[model samples]
Target: MSTATLINLVRNGGYQVRRRAVLTSRLLQDEKRPTAACYSSTSERRASRFDPDGSGRPTTWDTFGIWDNRIDEPILLPPSIKYGKPIPKVSLANVGCASHIGKRKENEDRFDYAQLTEDILYFAVYDGHGGAAAADFCDKYMEKYIKEFLAEEENLENVLNKAFLEINKAYERHAHLSADATLMNSGTTATVALLRDGIELVVASVGDSRALLCRKGKAMKLTIDHTPERKEEKDRIRKCGGFVAWNSLGQPHVNGRLAMTRSIGDLDLKNSGVIAQPETKRVQVKKGLLNRDSNIRTKGHHRYLMQVALPT
Candidate 1:
């Protein structure tokens, strides 16, 4: 697909959450290819202003927590019982991220990727609607909650499940304390991925933000969108005393309101089957893929695009 078409898809509410591309020597020779940074579909494309330092330039990389070089050490695991292949070390330096404000008056999307521990890496995206409050809250507290839950939970899946529910409750308390009634209606899509032991990838998601992995030039989807158009989601909403209605755009919505059936906030729809619980999935990265050059990038709204190309 053309890069412009991909950006439009994201702007139209379908995110290309995660993309992995393996760069062969031949692909690297193509100097005409764009860098991982974003370009606008219009004539006035500008660089993202996510500069962490006052360098007067767009940021290239951000280490969210204390930088630990030892975190780059690859895990030494015996050959997997099922695959009989040894896990390979993966470098965090190969990861890249970027974001743009898009067409919105204010950007409501928030994203963060960091080393959660010596053995785990965390990546998350929160797309807020109704307001930026929900997305902001997740951006600040999602990693904190995940780390806190990790102290008690051994399974990454359970850690994410608990973290999502806790974050919803925590946001409710925060809103209640702020005495802001409108905050209850604010909501965000949450898509989180955890990499453990360099090979296991566990993802938890609610709403429509997606995660995709490209292996050998093929796309592997990691999460499902939770929208009212889904039969299961629609049935659950109706079972919970809610009705689905289509808008002028022919898009299904819950009670003619939220387009998504599950989210982090949107407390007003809780009784109508809108939920904070996330569906989880787990996959293992092939050691061979990790040994090659890989790329990861996240999308904001269609008006904005971010790409991070990791050169081998």
Candidate 2:
């Protein structure tokens, strides 16, 4: 398929994964032929995006098929994970981030937040490596899926998890389609937070973008960075037949390539334990600050605030 056609396929194929089996078959058989006539029949063209079970839609996520035996790793340029908006000098509830592009040519960071209700807000940050497609894909579609899942389940945690999974599934399917093949080489780290009534804060994180909560003038870290050097992450990668090595800078990387152990769309690295599942945490929000709360274990007035920074 032409690059345009592939990009179009990825653009239009969001979350519809049932036809992947047939898509692979077609790539192996038809992609090599010289003519547009390679796809012989109108029926075959119609079946390009299959509705396998006749419901005219993809089934649940378990059937999306993200795991495969193929790996075509590509060389990446210098990482530009650093980028932030100008500091707003406002409260965390109405926070402003300062982002600047470093020496690298491309900045692969994305951030957004939405206030759903007067008391409810959603915020997110993505740190992308390799390329921008994975991060862009999540930035484009995560909120929509979150809204859909939230409507069905009142639990915010379940909604966040389901949203991440659905976004990854959709991006993976797009990467492997006859078009948009270049997307596979790219992946990103995702960090999302939901704030309710400017009081409660819930965050879901994958990979190394950090989130910290400041309450009563003390800083309490809210999320863990998923670097490969972490014990559990190292052990998991080894179990998956992947190895870790440190770059000259003394930072450990999975398979000597990616520095993080978990992420949203590292398709080539999944067999090595890079996954999209977010480490989720919900902090109790008591309107009144205390000398100490059981959840935060600190003595202070109840003032919940956020501090978000890009990778150095």
Full-model lDDT for every candidate: 0.75, 0.66
**Using alpha carbons, what is the TM-score of model 1?**
0.69
- Model 1, position 146: C-alpha lDDT score: 97
- Write the residue-wise lDDT of candidate 1 on 135-199 in tens digits: 99999999999999999899999999999999999998998898788898899998888887666
Candidate 1, residue 74: Cα displacement in angstroms equals: 6.6
Q: Which number leads on TM-score?
A: 1
TM-score of each: 0.69, 0.62
Work out how many backbone clashes candidate 2 has: 13
Best-fitting candidate, scored by lDDT: 1
